[model samples]
Target: MAVHHETAEELVEEVFLFGRALKLAVGNSDSSLLPPALTGVLGMLSIHGECRQTELASLLCLSQSALSRQLSDLVEWGYITRTPDPDDRRAALVRVSDSGFEILERIKESRVARLSTMLGEWSEEQALAALESVRHLKDTFTDQARHASADYTLIAR
Candidate 1:
């Protein structure tokens, strides 16, 4: 039987609601080792290797002072290190430490396991399709946000 448009829309909304609930639940869980902003910064550093503080601040849409405080905390925790940029002695580059990478790996594993358990009944094809759709939606939303406004700030708890 062909799926009705309304049914599909309803299913999409259900999935979105589930995702929101899951995020909130996870955020409240003790197992969440890092705050959202730190997690985001770590993820970006993990992918991009090392970056200057100014660049990171701009990319994360944070003010230099705010980013600096976050960086200070991470450095004190030994999760990341700051080093002088070889090309620019006055500028500093930040990179995830080995400990930080390990933390990221564990976080990725836990998140995958949690999602897989939640989606246990999903077929491989269905999961792949949903993943692709979510990725596309995320990219579209990010692009829209980038062009929409510059006053947005991520409030930290």
Candidate 2:
């Protein structure tokens, strides 16, 4: 139990360092790239497919007005498209555009290449262990998020 507590603390510290390194890498990359705000909007759209503006705003924790501004920027950047909701012509549903998907692919490739370069000196065993650890951590967080949402729903009711 003591060992687990110490390991968790160390893992948290390392995760903060990893986040700083990632932010630095992203900031040093192409200026034309999407900012984090825009990335979040696009990422949610990509994950949820198409969703109404109100629903998207709620998911993003942004007010409808704030989301409107971001959505306008996304549309202007050719990263996303808004279409009239078939169910209710008064509302619009948003989704990533084809060009946006291409850009996303490029961004993904760049990050993968960067990570590969950074890991170049690592032994195969070390790299595999790190990968497995990250995968487990991600799964744990995902499960917790789901559980929290379920709990919130129950509380709200």
Candidate 3:
């Protein structure tokens, strides 16, 4: 049966709620010691390399003050490095630290193991199909987000 837009929205919302709960449980079960926002910042840096504070804040849909607070905490934890932008003395660029990458790797391993156990009953084909569907969703969402951001930027200018 074809899913309607309202059904899709409800399903996505439920998934997000469950995902947040799972993230909290994972955080409590392990010594990873990361907040959701910090994890997001780290993941973005890891994927995108260095980014200006403003750009990162825009991408994260966070206010300047909020992003600054997150960046400060990450820097203090040695999970992120912030350096003055050479081209713009007033701005800073942020990147994930080596320690950050190490922590991410550990977290990834732990999560993967947990998922493996959770999905152990599922056949390989089932797992692959699920992964493929999720990947498609992610890609579509990312592309739309980029387009929306671009439009917002243009309007702002």
Candidate 4:
């Protein structure tokens, strides 16, 4: 069935509010946790695997210079590597290091622990339903984003 405009608007509002709540709740915890911006960049790199710096920049919707700052920290922390692209002498390839995967796992565990506390009262079935819904929504949006990536203008680096 076709989605109604009002329903779509309601969904958008809910998503915005949900995102805000997530940020306010879980995004600010733990001094050791990486900043949200870097975490997001790392997450993207994890998804894309080893890719050229320029290609990663394009995929991330960030200019090369902006991406460089984040990449620098990742490299320093041994979370990721930037090496010469063998196929392209002038280009660099980016890949998440083993430590990067470990950090990502830690981040996931911490976030899940916090969220689980928040959902402590939920029944197993209720939690599973919520998980299913979120996964479905995420997959749908991911597909949409890939299709629309070419048309999106970078708003931030």
Top-lDDT structure, candidate number: 4
What does the lDDT come to for candidate 4?
0.86
Worst 10 residues of 3 by lDDT: 24-33
lDDT for each residue of candidate 2 in 16-48, tens digit (9 for 90 to 100): 998788777763453367777777788788888
How well is each residue in 1-157 modelled by candidate 1, as lDDT tens digits?
9879999899779879977896765533424677767877888888878999998987788999999988897898888999999999999999999998988887777777777787889999999998898789779778888765543543321
- Poorest lDDT segment (10 consecutive residues) of candidate 4: 148-157
For model 2, the stretches where C-alpha displacement exceeds 4 angstroms are: 1-6, 26-28
What is the per-residue lDDT of model 3 for residues 1-157, given as tens digits with 9 covering 90 to 100? 8989999999899779877877765654445557666887888889888989888887778899998998899899999998899999898889999999987887777767777887889999999998898789789889998898899999999
How well does each candidate superpose onto the true structure, as a TM-score? 0.72, 0.82, 0.82, 0.85
State the local distance difference test value for candidate 3: 0.83
Global local distance difference test of model 2: 0.84
Q: Which stretches of candidate 3 lie over 4 Å from their true place?
A: 1-18, 21-31, 153-157
* Tens-digit per-residue lDDT, 35-151, candidate 4: 787888888999989998788888788998999999999999999998898988898888999999999888888887888898999999999998899899899998998767645
Best-performing candidate as measured by TM-score = 4
Q: Higher lDDT: candidate 2 or 4?
A: 4
Of 1 and 3, the candidate ranking higher by TM-score: 3
Specify the poorest-scoring 10-residue window by lDDT in model 1: 148-157
- Backbone clashes (count) for model 3: 0
Per-candidate Cα RMSD to the true structure, in Å, reads 6.9, 2.5, 2.7, 4.1
Indicate the TM-score of model 1.
0.72
* Candidate 3 lDDT score at position 55: 86
